[model samples]
Target: MTYLNGVQVSSAAVSTDPLSWLDERASERTDAGLRRHLRVREPESPAIDLASNDYLGLVRHPEVIEGAIAAVRRWGAGATGSRLVTGTTADHALLETELAEFVGAQSGLVFASGYAANLGAVTALAGRGALVVSDAGSHASLVDACRLSRARVEIAAHRDVAAVERLLAERTEERALVLTDSVFSADGDLAPLTELHRACRAHGAVLVVDEAHGLGVRGDGGRGLVHEQGLAGEPDIVITATLSKAFAAQGGVVLADARIRAHLIDAARTFIFDTGLAPAAVGAARAALGLLRRDPTMATRVLDRAADIARIAGVAEPDSAVVSVVLGEAQLAFDAAQTCRARGLDVGCFRPPSVPTGTSRLRLTARANLTTAELDVIAEVLSEVLADARGTERISA
Candidate 1:
């Protein structure tokens, strides 16, 4: 037996075949209903889109498209290099400044994707010997960041403020960070930001909140939950967000204190080593921000639609644009999603390990532009599909 990366493997087994094990793993996943496949979508889909994260429906808006086109015309197709090297353009600098001002942060830094932003922020804020107390339901990127931080990580119960406070108080490390998502991705539930902030303050820990689902839907004029809670400019608080969802663009931003921004610029490996956000994405995001600023009603429209969907689906009102309908099993959830698709509606299916075991669900996202006619169609389709799922469940039992 030999040890590789802390895992013991028999030499005979390694000698037999290295890639063969993957086939067995794949079969196991198939049997467990954990296999995933991608479906190619047409440029102009005929179905009412409930699977996409375009909460504000600005992806193809004339202004957003023009923003991208104009950027490509001016800055070419790519950023060309890492920000520290040669990629930081005037557009990037402008977007960063605008994003900071919008969120009431002292400074902001942009990354190629939200995943990179989360990774950079978490790892940079809490490193070797530091303590990281994260919520159990944080996004996968944040979870991965905790693992990579080389810190003593303690995962508190989901949305349990007292658990987080205990972890912070008991930590041996002098420096600690409390991490959570402002709006959880799967269930669309909100975090207790006020209580979490108070705990962080009492324990002398920094708090990092990922507002991927909160931005453009929670705060006044779509600033975000941090701004809504009046914690925007707090020195101990940091915010990370994605432009892909509500902004309908492709990038991420880390809003923090000026000192933290400078430190990340110097030490965040994902930012310093990875190529900067593309010029087109930066331009599109900036344009989307401008549109939101000019017409804050777009944010309210998304919430109204989400509430309407929740009513139709008989689910609790969502805190954001995402509404989840629990179907209880993977195959049932997949069947319901397919049924909805067949009826001219496209909804998302979530199975384990994306969600906890026994909590498979249909994930639906609301768009601000969905018309009354479209909502009626979605309502009818979901009602029929859910009824069928219940019948099947009763028969199986």
Candidate 2:
């Protein structure tokens, strides 16, 4: 007999069940009430949607649909090969230009997804003999990028500018990259970009801000937090964002100086090896961006709606579209989310790995197009749900 992942199995049994170790992990997850499930949603859900990152609510907009259809008609269904080969389309170049201009960057490079963009930017820019300082609350993609960058990685305290500065000042490497999210994904908190950028400048480090939750939900005309803070065209700042969120499409992009963009094109493995973003996603994102450009008020509308949701839930308004009601314990948060769903409202339930062990939460994301009636319903449902789930300890900042 042998112990496989602490599960006792006979030699003969191991031959029959080579993957039996996974069962023990699955059982552990179930016992901890941390097992996740995939609920298949229809094209349109009947429930009021407070669960998605569609800040501009343009996913189903007619122009966006038309843009996608037009791209498919013009460029075919797939990118076919890596950009270095045959995947780069006219639409890709146009979208990259439009995005760079919109975000006030000297240049831009699109990627297969936000994750790939982070991987590409970090890996291509910072490698051996470099130091990387990451915010504690950065997205998982950035964390993975740091690990894969082959640099000495240090996790500064969450949004702690002083800590970031200390790490940069103490680093022995010739080059350093500071990575953070302009808007935190789970808690919807804003990073101290200006302070961090100042520190980076003082220490001669590059600052990389992932605007995954910032673009289309922050800044004047949805230009993102970096643009709002006047860091858009800074030579040492690199901005990464996802089109899948507010752009109502797919893909990711890195916005930076022309030189940085050139280096990524040549050295970023994710870009050199991955297929270019599909034409439909490029077109749809472009159309969505065009809509946001035409009506910058959509940014304000989404933030206002988020404030409304926060007020109704008896929680402080978040900096971004994400409004979290931290209900202690994983099962409790899960139950609260299910209760909201039963009341015809769909909200995000974050637990365990997404947040701290004791800080499970019901996450509600606001959209620009939420109607007054929808807000009222959210208020009613959350009121009832919280009334029952409020016995737990409140969330800490």
lDDT of 1 by residue, 204-285 (tens): 9999999999999889988999999989899999999999998989989999999999999988999999999998998899
- Give the TM-score of each candidate: 0.95, 0.95
Q: In model 1, which regions exceed 4 Å deviation?
A: 1-15, 392-397
Task: Report the poorest 10 consecutive residues by lDDT, candidate 2.
Answer: 388-397
Looking at model 1, residue 45 earns an lDDT score of: 86
RMSD of each: 3.7, 3.6
lDDT over C-alpha atoms for residue 375 of model 1: 87
> lDDT tens string, model 2, 341-377?
9999999999989999999999999999999988888
